[model samples]
Target: MKDLVIVFPGQGSQFAGMGKQWFDGNRVVRDRFGQASDLVGYSLADLCFTAPPAEVTRTRFAQVSLLVLSYAMYEVMTEDRKIPVSAMTGHSLGEITALLAAGALTFEDAVRLVKARGEAMESCVAESGTGMVAAVRMPVADVEKCVEEFNSGGHDVQVANYNAEAQTVLSGTLDDLKGLTAHLEDRGAKVVKLNVAGAFHSSFMADAVPAYTEALHEVEFTEPTVPVYSNVTGEAHESPQSIRESLAVQLTSPVRWSAIVASLVERKAAVWVEVGPKQVLKKMLTGAVGSGEVHSFDEEPERVRAVLDQLVELKKREPGLVGLCLGAAAATRNRNFDTAAYDQGVVLPYRKLQELSKLDQETLSDEQKQTALDLLLTIMRTKQVPEAEQRDRVESILRRTGDAGLRTIAGALAT
Candidate 1:
């Protein structure tokens, strides 16, 4: 494995005795947890390690508790161990742990960010806003279309969490969520109402972002010693300034985990790690790399006596191993190569091409592939499409592999 990407879980993953086993034996882990408690002033250890279930279950306890354990586990693993940590990323609430682990923010800074985030999340939920529910076994476009249909019918709903293929969560006002849930269930999704207070990661969170942004300005984020892949674009952020802004927007923005996974896999990452009590992040990562190996924070104590056990074992078996890599876009900018826009508003299983490239090889069958190549030429040659339409058409091309079984679709690429 070249680089290690450790993922962390968010609010719902917390429990009263999350890291007790490790904390009992590890002086370093205890010390770090105490450090977080001192910064928060009220004794996070009391709330995390020893609080009653009811208290620990509060939003106040839930968010902070999760962060403390995740950060401490990370410290125990990396402080004296030889973990092959080349890069890292975290989910919604876990982003703080990632920032701290990547050296972009101090432990104190991350805890404070968590304090504000928990408060913000709580406040947003307190409103008469609707709830959130995960809808599984449905296509992305179908899920999106379902949200659209609900809204068009006067329910203010949108897809909030895009967890993985066939799994997504939606959010809106209570009525909106309820109505959409019914519609989505009718459309064949295994729906589960999440145990979340408010609808997060949707427009419903817009009101909370400004306050969070202002909070960000009060703190200073360092240029990360490691690049932390952001959920905003599913790519590594450029600087502290960019990351600060991104953190604020993250509450309201859709988590592009699929894109993040695509970027990591496209780069052929060595291994991915999940640094939380449960394997929630591991599940998300499995979607990205079905056959890949992943190291996580929830292993047994004796099993993980070393933080980088998997790394040592991996390297011993295969030293100097490198993965097959995708070539970069030809230096000549292909402004027309993006396949995202074309993917929008269209059915998933019905993917079609919108760009022109790679019709020469055996990646595609001869008949359908040639038609796609021709479609690309039509748009580029005619320039007849509205600029927006042309852009969509171009992306549509690249997103589709092997063409859509249409001679018209394939042949249009050569235009």
Candidate 2:
């Protein structure tokens, strides 16, 4: 669970009725959609469930709808279980959803920021004739060279998305893209014009940056509870200030998606959950990371239930402080062979921890949890376990359970 990385999708993955199942099955999800509708000044539920494909696909409508749906899926998935997320990230518009998942932004604020962002991008498109195209089965280097050739010839085209090693997205003027499309096909790469509104992640969207940045400034960005990768930097955002700056410039910045995947792989992320409306990110992971347990929560009901059930089983199997204390008591060799001290320290606290572990974890108050942790540490200390090792074990438990209340106690112990 410490290796779990949850991802969200962005635009182009949306479709009519994308989140219908969750909307119908969960009242909280329904409420979230309602809240989003109010914030965006439109019936998002209607747009997602009953609107025509053309209407739902518009950038202004698609961005917020996908955000709400993705965030709702995330909420439903984690409501009853704790997912020890190692990190979270998203494609272009999905980065906003990632922030929401990581607790950096409230749903209301995310909705407003995304709404303004979508509107700003759409406005930029209206002012200029620009679009995007996907170049597949081509090396990123070759694709960049093609883009460079076009740019050197006075075209504004740029490689806007390094989606994968073999898939890249280019954005520029329609005429220039048309010419580039023919050139790419001639080079043996399949080029499909993307159904997008503007030359996103290119200088063509520069005007939108100021507007999006203005909206960004109005919202408060707190430190993420878990790491959230940035599309602009292809790395984990370091701080709230960094997030603010990265997001402001994201409009005209290429989505370094391949770089993000490489970073996750470097971190040895072993389990990936795409908690969004489509399997786009899941497919991307298969080609990028190459090996991992990948699940698309939105693809099927059974898949979603399977992941939730697995988390529940994992939580039950986590022995918490009891396992730590008992293992240390049994494993650490007796130094002084002080039997009475061992009985008073190790045996007594180990029994107490066993009893505490039997209680419903949710029913345990913060004081009780802290007391149990303290008992485990004392037993480890009595058994002559290294202080650093004890801290490591405690931190491992914290990572697996992601218990914020326990984190407070762990932080105090660290000091």
Candidate 3:
């Protein structure tokens, strides 16, 4: 099995019919949804499949729905596909889902916890005039400088989510946010407003802290089966008190997503699967892991299965393929396909042919085979090894293959 880090998504990732396909097709998901509905006192299936978008988008409902759907996806990926989860982390509300996946929280307690937390957040939002805005293409230091400058002038804006290398989310009063946007834009940052009910992960959430903390007391946090990163510290937590405290502080703490990804990379996370309703986390991971393997399970079943098959083979043959594919996926997601950095790693080129030699000719589509070939070509072209020796080695490997398509790719690369 691949060393997979299962990353869950947070708000802004939910929608009606988010997990309808899985619910309709999988008995386990249906059963899990039934239990969640019982615990939360509402048919999550109804709200997720047919409720008005507005209702589902409410903080209370949105949080619950995202948790339920992401949990269902986790069940499908782990129980059905039998994918081993190495470590887990989440963005915002997703941290709860990660906790559940890690076995740190029971499903029922998790449901109740998020429901209480969401209601508290919604209450806070209803009583405050606060929101969040994205500062794009700006480094964290610059965003912090902007926040400091604004807060020094008696404004209340603060960093909420450190989403990526170039993205940061600020939460504060609407008027303050509007003013800060201009200041941020002046500093060469592209500011885009987010449609959130309140300024989560800021001091505005202080009022909700006690209620969330009280609710957390009711839940039992067990030892996790896998390493679970805390959004509060971007590190792993094992103690029950530590996990509980982390969850409460997470409300008022900047989601250290960039830091969490860095930590995962440091541990050599072989593959990252964003098990949620959308591709949001997968996109953020690209810039963070830089040519690491990432995949999303929100697509049609065939596509998901195909990707999983490829991942299994990649894991078995060339683990480094995970990083290459991740970088490539990140590049594709960000609309930048240049692989200059990917070509520079010394060991990447050495095993290029060995990795390609295991491709399943019958299982992979033509385009999939070509993609592997293209990566091999890129890895080979770098000055990591002598061209003649690399060519001889690759040709030797190709001659041993029974795959006609792979050989055809070898011929193309030869000329």
Candidate 4:
């Protein structure tokens, strides 16, 4: 699906039996758990499937288990389906999952890195005595003002996550956060203490960053196959170095989730898939883009699959040879050519393709379809589009349409 965005959830989304369905139903998931256990020196399957809530909620266990499960679900969902993911992103710890899914990091590297990151954060919690609280039904500006007051008072509190328009998370020493409750309540906001270990995404997490950066340095990052939005920057990472740097600072930097959602909306993201435990990201997406279609794989795998299948069928039905010609003509950007020859070679063919696009697909004869494909090829050639890109466009169109004749033509072009 075009403009499909895949999102992953971070900490606070974990629970007992988070990935039991995938663990039991898919061999690949089981294998991933097995491999992850070998890397982390613990039975991740047992941790996820049988552990108690308290045990599973520990940061050290929660982070790696969540990543493994999320990655497994992503693999299972996309193994057979050619989902054209326009972009991918995750919240906090989920960013690592997104990186792994986008091929920026290997499975082994991700497991080891997350394991180290979780342990480092747990250590930070033990040393710092910090905590987090969710401030709901409050505007972010007000939250920032409250945090500024706290910081000005030398309390070291900060806004950790801009989750939604009306929800923000604050992180600091437990006493400072507890002190905010009455003040936030005075402003008609609800303050709920989060069940987390430390003040993540704040100065309290500074101790965790050095070790996490070391862990990051140990891994070799590559370019992602798809655009992966960064939580630290609220934008797509420009390079592997930028990914590393953003991740290095992510421990103490606020998660700009609202900005990320806004960017996705600006990009015209149509369908959103949350490939992690619970519907945490889905709820946030709904808050940001009201009535946006979001499918949570962890909460409803069958429904997500059905929805995706429907999308594939609809895509196949809507775009025919005429649509393909128009898409190809639009995609070819090279324009350095002779003006007179271009008018006769490209302009006339494009007009014909536009005329053909208006009529019903069923009414178009095979000859007309062939003519449309020829016109698209002619336009590509006149525009000086590279042969490889032209082939890719034609093959993509053929796959979407399931047109055997077009596939034959595409195969001939491949040669």
By lDDT, who's the top model here?
4
Please give the CA lDDT of all the candidate structures.
0.66, 0.83, 0.76, 0.84
Model 1 off-target regions past 4 Å? 300-307, 310-415
Global Cα RMSD, each model? 13.7, 5.2, 13.5, 7.7
- For residues 84-174, what per-residue lDDT tens digits would candidate 4 score against the true structure? 5667899999999999998899999999999999999999889577889999998999988877876686767788999888999999888
Every model's TM-score = 0.73, 0.80, 0.74, 0.79
**Per-residue lDDT of model 3, residues 205-293, tens digit only:** 99899999999999988766566889999987746678888998889989999988998787667678888887998888876786677
Clashing pairs in 3: 291-323, 291-327, 292-326, 292-327
Clashing pairs in 2: none
Model 3 compared with the native: what TM-score?
0.74
lDDT assessment of candidate 3: 0.76
Kindly report which residue stretches of model 2 are placed more than 4 angstroms away from their true locations once superposed. 315-415
Clashing pairs in 4: none
Answer with 2 or 4, whichever has the higher TM-score.
2
| Shift of residue 198 alpha carbon in model 2, Å | 0.9
- 252-310 in candidate 1: lDDT tens per residue? 88887777777767656656778878778777677567556666668644444453675
